[model samples]
Target: MEKSGENYKVISCGDVASLGRVVLHDALALTGAEVSINELPAGVSVPFVHAHKNNEEVYVVLSGKGFLFIDGEEFAIQEGDAFRIDPKGERCMKADDTSAIRFICVQAKANSLEGFTQSDGVLSETKPSWL
Candidate 1:
């Protein structure tokens, strides 16, 4: 949903950072998946390792650096890095005292894909099909 002249909702990263251990969800309306902005202060991590029973999550790092521990493996992640984990995997994140971390986490049920076809490849009704 647009607000006034804007085409989409916007949330300030600076505004969110002030609140520690915060994850902002449903900031924008959507049909297929849920989204959240996750922030962690230095030396703190999401308190528990989580494994979702019905949804898979993709984490996109927006800033800072951290270790993403999934099961028993640790992967270093920094800005612009993105990773997806299955519903059965145990995962969590941690940021050291050196810097804070912010990221976008999007979740949806596994194997669910939503799409629409405006045109079909070989049909006249599909004119301008490649648009």
Candidate 2:
């Protein structure tokens, strides 16, 4: 599907992987807010402990068991579990050993890499920084 103002595309899990498709990517609002729907395969991790200078994000678990590591703290998450992180905090997540973790990640205000950098002085998103 297409939308006005900015680019809007329907990406599946299959697009991100192979089996499932229609997942959303790079859907950043004019306000710099970004939204994405991700469908993780049976075993996948959400990536590394990256921090955003001015973007607070929330993760809502949709299916399967979930595991999240925020600033070195580990957590056991399940269906209906929601994890929220503030800007400048190091965070990352992973899927359970037996099942995949499907979740929607939402970022408000500082969605763009530029905006995030402007919010704080950071060279890269992968590096550790404080807000």
Candidate 3:
């Protein structure tokens, strides 16, 4: 499901409770980032190891167990784990034999964040409806 207005958009990914990938770039008309929800079944690895030319990626593990391989090193990941990889780092992921793994990956240009949150937000006089 999706809804949009002049400056905002809301989308529902439906049920992400199974093994699959959901890429949100085109769905949301994103201009600056690529985001995807990925799920891997037990004992399965991503089809290929990859590195981005200009974008760094952050992954947040939402459920299950997995191993993240980055530049020849392996790190165990599970629910609530989050990590970032540099643009050129080789990376791949595999779900453990006993559990499927689901994660969200957010990719954006390397070194592109100029300001965030406190430094970028302004106090607006308009109040939220809940207030």
Model number with the top TM-score? 3
**Which is the better candidate, 1 or 2, if ranked by TM-score?**
1
Clashes, model 1: 0
Which prediction has more favorable lDDT, 1 or 3? 3
23-129: candidate 2 lDDT, tens digit per residue: 24343223455566666666677656798878898888878886788888998988898877888779877778788777778787544455344676656456556
| True-vs-predicted CA distance for residue 21, candidate 1, Å | 6.3
State which candidate, 1 or 2, has the greater lDDT: 1
User: How badly does each model clash, as a count of residue pairs?
Assistant: 0, 9, 0
Q: Please write out the lDDT profile of model 1 over residues 18-117, one tens digit for every residue.
A: 7553344555555567777778887778899999988999989899988899988997889899999999999999986787888889888998854436
Model 3 Cα shift for residue 87 (angstroms): 0.8
Error of 3 at 77 (Å): 0.7
Model 1 vs. true fold: TM = 0.72
Off by over 4 Å in 3: none
lDDT of 3 by residue, 24-89 (tens): 998899999999998998999998999999999999999999999999999789999999999999
Top candidate by lDDT: 3
